[model samples]
Target: MNFAFSLPLALAAALLDVTVGYPQAVYRAIGHPVTWMGAFVAALESRLNRPTLAFEVGRASGVFALALYLGAVGVVAGLVSSLAPSGVVGFAALALLASSLPAQQSLDRHVLAVARGLEQGGLAAGRSAVAKIVGRNPETLDEAGVARAALESLAENFSDGVVAPLFWIALGGVTGGALYKAVNTADSMIGHKTERFLAFGWAAARLDDLVNLPASRLAALWLIAAAAVTPDASAREAWLTVARDAGRHRSPNAGWPEAAIAGALGLKLAGPRVYGDRLVDDAFMGAGRREADAADIIRALKLYRASCVIQALALAGAALIAQA
Candidate 1:
């Protein structure tokens, strides 16, 4: 798949996700026993002791998820294609592919849930939400800490949740899209700095980084463009911040968007946060506006929306060019 088809798929996916995702999530919640089974299986997988056993278990989990996702796509694509014209099948494939990708709405909802906990002054609730968003411990975070956690997640996931999947789908079709999701899921489940997963999970994590590189930079550029669109916003500042601070992040790819978002929002991001009992004094990104609150979260949400629009427009342009 190239931009010609991929653009429509991207748009369809974004639209479908925004319009129907909540209901679908609700329906899945109510109807799916498989979800419970998956959770149970994940629990079992998480508890494996031996490294070799863990690797085997991880591999099985990866293959299972890949097969299931791809199989579903194939079945759906076939059904849609059979009932309609080939063009319709193509469009439907795009729609189905889009449906698989996460949306800004979902991301905002999760972050807002955390913000609500923070506003209520319940550290535990806030911590729980933060933990869901980030890998860090919530127990040790302050208000600033919680805000940063959400912001960093917002930035990094903007690439992972939005950009990376679309990039793959456009490049390789539904199979590629599904494969990207599987790899990302594996990274989330097994990729960690913990002693147990250090060696085995390294491959998954590195592969994920490799895949995310271009998408991450694209996300950053989209963010910078978004910043330019805001009244009185400074593209120069955004560029400078991204250039200066993006490298400060631990992950090569993640810092790009985080830095861009911080620069766009004129806020500082990524400082020391508690991970379990240890404090990782990570380098901060951006310069102007360091202190964040609920309002900043709302701003980040706007940035998210703007970035999505930019991405869509870019895809559309690419499609038009291909046609030309």
Candidate 2:
């Protein structure tokens, strides 16, 4: 499709990622972008997030630290973007770099592995496979719990890991995508309520919330559309579920996709769950069956994959229209 540069860049990167995900060899060679960013975030936190500092002082330092790091990442991405020549090779190289930010293929593989583990070995295998993707305590999970956890992680991350980064890239190209990844990495690492990070993670958490706003809503809509086409999935219920339950989620962004997927598949997700001995009694997203199984995980994967296709098509359409 002949499209404008801004959106085309994101579309190209997304297509590239869907075609071939980040390579294991490349990761071993230089590490992934998020990991590299995490190293920087860890160093900055060690130096800036002092326990001796008072609450507000630590918070201000967090703001400063976030600004410093995000600024550095943005500058670097921009430099790389500028250095690329104005032709096919340069464009391909930039798109390749941008492709690393979205994890559509990997998310599918991880979530699917949970299904395979359940199918092949049972609860222990399911838990083991799921643990790679979710942060909740795997030992506390039963078969249903493992399935729910896997599906929940799949739904939530589809928004965060795939849609949000692509949304930024569609708007601002590689630098924008890189900046979002930096903020997200910071949030994942430090955005905790513990005494150690409650204040220090404020900026990262807040900004992540802001950047993810539009994508979350858009993601829900796409999931709803996906539900319409998938067998036995309820598009009507998906819309109703999102309208009724999306806001009930603890996260501003995660609930949208989670609720849509829950309603589409007629399953309950993200209810009470254990996270490192802490029980988070969050509201359930769908008023459907709580006894989710590997089959349901497969169902959710169908919806997730459909949603990805729908989103990519939407971006392509938007780009074509913009260029026209």
Q: Who wins the lDDT comparison?
A: 2
Tens-place lDDT per residue, model 2, 1-324, is 223876888888889999999999999999999999999999999999986789899899999999999999999999998999999999899899999999999999999999999999999999999999999889999999999999999988898899999988988889989999999999999988778998899888898899889889988999999999999899999999999999999999989999999999999989888899788989999999999999999999999899999988988998888888
Total clashing pairs in model 1: 3
TM-score of each: 0.81, 0.98
Full-model lDDT, candidate 2: 0.92
Which tens-of-lDDT digit does each residue in 1-324 have in candidate 1? 566766666666766766666466665667432243345335544654346556566555544543454456446544543454467775785576456555556777888877787778666777788788888877677776778789889999989988887777666555566567656765776577776666556656777888889889999999899887765456778899999988879888988998887887788898776777777788888886666776677677777788788887887777688677
Minimum summed lDDT over a 10-residue window in model 2 is located at: 1-10
Which regions of candidate 2 fall more than 4 Å away from where they truly are? 1-3
For residue 236, what is the lDDT in candidate 1? Answer: 77
Clashes per candidate (backbone, < 3 Å): 3, 0
For residue 295, what is the lDDT in candidate 2? Answer: 95
Name the weakest run of 10 consecutive residues (lDDT summed) in model 1.
32-41
